[model samples]
Target: SEMMIMANWLMARFLSERNLPAIFRSQPDPKERLYNEDQGTLFQNWMQRRLLSRFVLSSRSERHSGLGLNAYLTATSPIRKYFDLVTQRQIRSAFDLDTPYTDREIERSLHSLEQPMFSVSRLQYQRKRYWLLKYLEERIGKKEEALVLNRRRNGYQVLLTEYLTECMLPVSSGVSMRSEDMIQVTIQHVNARKDTLSVYMA
Candidate 1:
């Protein structure tokens, strides 16, 4: 199923490219900046990050206010993931007994499901983070262009050019910077044991 979804997305991209108008494909007689200072106001609503919540349901009725029951009822997962087996068992038990799990019971089950998954995710992040710090440590004292992504009272976050990896820039480095600024920076510190990389404006 995942392969099929990926194949379909690839096909869509190919088709979109093939169907693009010739004018869009050809070089402009005189290229112009795609966006200008005057248009900055048009993108004011763009946020760096935002969280979203959604509820899914299967059926709707007057009493339900048309919100409907969960449509994910028929969802299935392969045996590889433990949660799928647990879900299959719970669903079978519910149907066989003619009584679905209570809302609180379902909520508790879902909440508990996150623990192992989060552990796995954290482990993978730590592994990658270890390699990133090691790579940066070898390049200490080297300079590179970076974009500031965040600012705090003590330090800021900068994304390096080559790896696009983020590292901290301490205020004590005496290099003043603001978020979203592009500037040349040098690695000032790297603690591979702690998976930390620190930099200063070059």
Candidate 2:
């Protein structure tokens, strides 16, 4: 949690310093989501839209994770992320290490890397969602307690308080809910192929 608090502050500082429209890639709280990690995939869809600068964030309690740090670069996931690969090349260049890819060469690759990286990320997301859906299918009819994270147009989105899961529940036309409200929800439906989960208020 302390790491996340520090990371979040660093992210805030970086954004404030540059005034850039930014992308924050955050995962679930390490205290919890570190186990299942789907919370990390919470905003897979939003991160891909046409955006300004890209940066990483981690460890937020809500769906969006934020671990604030002044600067972060990926040096892992060579197959799934080009930026990490580029970072690796940059590190090599810093050590006066000879390689086919130079700092300048990697610098020139960023423009082309964005779209492809996004595609790779989306594919991996779909794969994970598939497995999660399958897991949900097995647990159908079970009731779980969740925290109200946000109230949306149709209803509310809740994060499972005990399990590493989340889902949306539609409100009766005039009903309302507030953030942080504790609610009970039943795992009602799951479609693995479509990556859809249906939950009903209990």
Candidate 3:
């Protein structure tokens, strides 16, 4: 992954310097920082993931803050992604082996891909989450150890240690819990189709 990022970053810069039109991936800076160092506890990393900004596609070059790159595109996985293939073609154009896509052509391609990409990503996440929830449903009534990730206004966000699945645990007004604290919780309900899960202190 590190090498792919480096290759993508260098290729993006190469295309940008030559005024080539390639589908560039850009990400804004995270809304906030949870930690500064590379090494952080699982809870800290989870918090930081929540703060990350979504990456966007563009015809022109822009900063990709998530990867700490001035410009970046995924040119290493041509078989797996459409934009990656487009980028690979752009790189070939730099070597006089292929015709480059015009800026308008890249923009049109991105516009056409927006919805299909979103649907595919959403379906992938929903399917994975559904199976995880189904697994929890079978183990309903069992006590599980969970780590408190954060305390919300109405409840606490906790992750089941065994499955690494997160669910909300509502507490009474007077109950106290802190982030990173471990607590026993009982799975009370789960409905994968509706994407619902409920838990309570055990």
Candidate 4:
């Protein structure tokens, strides 16, 4: 949390000092503005699209997995996390007694550790995502060419002018278009509630 706060501050300072074109400006209180509603929606759409592409279409081998009991035991931390330390002590006790914990006990210990780890990981992920979106929001209202990557039931996902950033052009958002059509998009969304950009074929 501290790191994320510091990063936000640093970005604000950088943007201000360099006269950067960004969707937001620094406030003394550390609050940020998206510069526009469309930009926010575009950013959100981009993040969701990128996440879907990477996770849903990526190779199975690229996914994370635990090997087995050893993997589960090692995944829990012995320091810093309370549940991890407790689990470690329990496992150590069983080992010292020449009777290891049952599979169910080990599984339960691992399950108990998952919630905290996932919570921490998700917080970090969201913080990073916000920063990245802020960076792009700075470029709002600019016309850019993009490629249509996929057509959803409601809209199509497009790769933005920048590399790797994908945003959805939802039909409800007023871009009634088809897939594989190159288009010029004016950033129409960027805010705390949404991160998206609007587009139409040039």
Best prediction by lDDT: 3
Ranking under TM-score, best-scoring first? 3, 2, 1, 4
> Model 2: which ten-residue window has the lowest total lDDT?
44-53
Question: Could you report the Cα RMSD, in angstroms, for every candidate shown?
Answer: 13.8, 10.2, 2.4, 17.7
After superposition, the stretches of candidate 1 with alpha carbons farther than 4 Å from their true spots are: 1-47, 50-80, 84-109, 171-176
- lDDT against the true structure, per candidate, is 0.51, 0.57, 0.90, 0.48
- In the range 98-197, model 2's lDDT, one tens digit per residue, is 3435334544565456677679879998888788789878989999887777778888878776655668898798778887678888888889987788
Candidate 4 Cα outliers beyond 4 Å, as residue runs = 1-102, 161-163, 170-184, 193-202
Model 3: weakest 10-residue lDDT segment is 33-42
Across 117-173, the per-residue lDDT of candidate 4 in tens digits comes to 679979887777677677667766767777676778767888775645667766566
Query: How big is the positional error of residue 146 in model 1, measured in Å on the Cα after superposition?
Result: 0.9
Work out how many backbone clashes candidate 3 has: 0
Q: After superposition, how far is residue 190 of candidate 3 from its true place, in Å?
A: 2.8
Runs with alpha carbons beyond 4 Å of true place in candidate 3: 152-154, 161-164
Candidate 3: Cα lDDT at 109 = 97
Better of 1 and 3 by lDDT: 3
User: What is residue 110's positional error in candidate 2, in angstroms?
Assistant: 1.0
Please give the clash total of every predicted structure, in order.
7, 9, 0, 25
Considering lDDT, where higher is better, how would the candidates rank from best to worst? 3, 2, 1, 4
**lDDT value, candidate 3, whole model:** 0.90
Instruction: Return the lDDT, model 4, position 46.
Output: 45
Q: How many backbone clashes does candidate 4 have?
A: 25
